[model samples]
Target: MASPSSLLSQEQIQCICLDIFTSPISTPCGHNFCMACIGGYWDSSDVCQCPLCKETFYRRPDLCINRTLKEISEQFKTRLSLFEEQYAQPGQVPCDICTGSKLRAVKSCLVCLASYCQTHLEPHQRVGTMKTHKLIEPVSNLEDRLCKKHQRVLELFCREDQTFVCVLCNETDHRTHNTVPAERECTEMKVSFL
Candidate 1:
C-alpha cells in the first residue's frame, strides 16, 4: 500500500520555475505559471502570449492568483514536508541533491548514480530524457552498486555465475552466461523462497 504523499505527481504541482507553485496565476489561454515568472516573461516580451501553445492575447491577462490552485499547492507542500520529516529517520539513504539537512531518498537512479528525495526527483518524473533513467528502491553507497569492471549499473543477474552483472559484462566475459534483468531474477528468487 502506497502512502498518501507517495501518490503526489510533482509534474502537475510545479510551474515554469521548476519549483512548486508560488502565487499561481492562470493565463487567458488556460496555462498556469507562477506570478513572478509570468510577470517577468511578459515584461521582457513585445506581445502578451502564452509561454506554452504560443497563443497571442489581444490584451494582458489578469494578475489575480487562482485561489484553488494556491490552496492545492499549499496543501501539497505541507504534506511533502511532513512526509520528508517522517522518512528522515536513521538507517535510510539520504538524497544526494539535498543540501543543509538531507531528506531520506525515495528513489535511486541507475543512470545518474544518485539518490533523490521526493522534491529532488522531479526532473526524472517530468523531463523526457530523464524519464528513461532506471529508478529503484533507495540504496546507500551508489558507487558500490556499479559493476567495477564495466563501470555500468549492475542491472543484470548472471544466473550461471550467480552474480550481479552489467550490460558490458555480458558483451565480454559473460557472453556465454545465462543472464536476465536483475528485477526478474529477484522476483523469481522471491517466488522460489515462498
Candidate 2:
C-alpha cells in the first residue's frame, strides 16, 4: 500500500486538512474536501462548486461521508501521531504496542501489564473481559504495583508496615496486622488530613 504522503499530494492534504479530518466528502467533480469546509464555503457563496476544480453544480448534491477517504485520513493521523510520539517527552509513558514510533500512553492496564495510546486502547474499552481490568493513568513504573515475593498485584495496604501488600502477603507476613484496600487507606489518610 502507498504511504499516506505518497497517496495524496501535499497540496491535496493541505486543502482537506482542517483541525482534524472529522467528515471527509467527495465532490461529483472527483475532488475531496472536509464536509465542514465544503458546507461552510457553499454557505457563504451563491453557487455550489468543487473548491479545487470550481466545477459548479446546478443543485446542491446530498453529501455522504467518503468512507475510503476517511479511512485513509485516519491511517494518516495514526502515522502522524506515531511520528510525533517518537520524540515523546522525558516523563511521558510510551505505548508498548507501537513499534517504530511509540505514542504516549493514555492508559496503563494492570492486567495486561501494558501501556496503550488512545488508538491502541480502544480494545480495552470495548472488549468485555478487558473492560474489567484495572486501568490507571499512565505510569512508567508498573513493577511498583506488583509484589516482589508473591508476584501478584499489590491491592492492600498494611497499616502497620505502611506499605502496599498483595493478597498472599496479607495471608502470610501480614496475617496479624491491620490491613485495608489501598483505596480505603488513601481515603482514610485524606480524611485525617482534613
Candidate 3:
C-alpha cells in the first residue's frame, strides 16, 4: 500500500491552480480539490461537478475545508515556501529534495531533474552512476532545460537555430546544423569577441 505521503503528491497536483495548492476540500464523491478552485469552477458552471471524475451534483455540495487534508497541505505549503525562499535570492536555486527549511542549491543534476544544496548533493558526488549525471550550476525550472520534443537534456547548442538541442535533436532535426556542446560554444563565442 502506498503511504499517505506518497499520495499527497498527487493530491497537491489535483488541488492546485497554477501549481499552488491552498485550502483543500473534498466533495461528496470523495474527490479533493482546493476550495477556491472548486468554488470558482462551480460559480462559472451550471452544475456542480467533480472536475476530475465528472460526477455531477444537481445541487451545490455543502463544501467545508477538509480538516486533515488542510493541515497536511498547510505543512507541505510551509515547507514549499521554505524551499522557494532560497531561490528568491539572486543567482540561487532551491533544493527540490529538501524537507524543511532549505538551503540554496549548489548544483542541478540533469538526470535527477532536481537541484540540491551542498549537503543534499553528497550522494550524487559519491555514487558512481550518479556521478555520471551532468551537474550544472543551479538553475530554476529544470524542466525548461529539456528539449521540448525529445524530452532530453539540452546539452548541445545548435549554432544554426541559436537554440539548445538534445542528443536526439542532433540526430534528427538538427543533423544538418553546426552543433557543439553548449560549454564549447560559449568558449568559442568568447574567443571570437577577443
Candidate 4:
C-alpha cells in the first residue's frame, strides 16, 4: 500500500507539467509518467524508478499517449494564461521557481517565497483523485501572513475559531476548534463583509 507521503496524485502531477508536452508512458512498474518528464528522469538512471512510488524495474516500457490527458493539459494552459492576464497586478508577477510559468497569485506562502500555481502547490494530504495541496488562498496578506505565536505560515482555516492558522494550531491551541465547511465560511463571511 502506498502511504500518503509516498504517492503523488495523478491530477496534481498532471497540473505540474500542464505547460509541458505530456503523453502517457508506462514504466516497468506499471505506473504512468508524463512521457517527456519521465524521459528526462530516466536519462541518468540504470533502471527507471517510479518518481512517486520509488518502485524500480528493468526494461523499456510502453509509450502510450493518453489523448484525454494531453487535451486537458492544453486547455488548462490556455485557461491559466487567460487567468494571469485578467488578474495582473502592476509589477509583481514572476515566473514560479518550480514550473517556470508566470505566477498568477493564485496561492502564496510567506515561508515558501511567494506565489505558486496549481502545478507547483505542495500537498499537505493526499486524498482521492486530487491531492489537497497546502496553499494560501489570497497568497498575499503581509500583516497576518505568518502565525504570530507559532511563526508558521497559516495554511488551514479554523471555522470554529473563525481564524486562519498553521497545522500546528490544530494540534495544539485550536485542537478543539469546531471546524465547519469552507463553503459555509465563505458564504457567511461574504454576507457579513458585504
Q: Candidate 1 overall Cα lDDT vs. reference? A: 0.88
lDDT of 1 by residue, 44-63 (tens): 99999988889998888778
Candidate 1 clashing pairs, residues 3+ apart or interchain: none
User: Between 1 and 2, whose lDDT is larger?
Assistant: 1
| C-alpha RMSD by candidate, in order | 17.4, 9.3, 13.5, 18.7
Candidate 2 residue pairs that clash: none
> Quick one: ranking by TM-score, best first?
1, 2, 3, 4
Clashing residue pairs found in predicted model 3? none
Summarize candidate 3's per-residue lDDT along 54-156 as a digit string, tens digits. Answer: 9999899998988887777677666656555554266667788887555788899999999998878999989999988889888898999998998999999
Quote each prediction's TM-score. 0.56, 0.55, 0.52, 0.36
lDDT per residue as tens, model 4, 117-161: 544454422444333433456444544666788887666679777
Kindly state the number of residue pairs that clash in model 2.
0
TM-score for predicted model 3 compared with the true structure: 0.52
Model 2 spans with C-alpha error above 4 angstroms? 1-87, 190-194
- The per-residue C-alpha lDDT of model 1 at residue 148 equals 95
By lDDT, the candidates rank as 1, 2, 3, 4
Model 2 lDDT per residue over 34-73, tens place: 8888899999999988877889999998999999878877
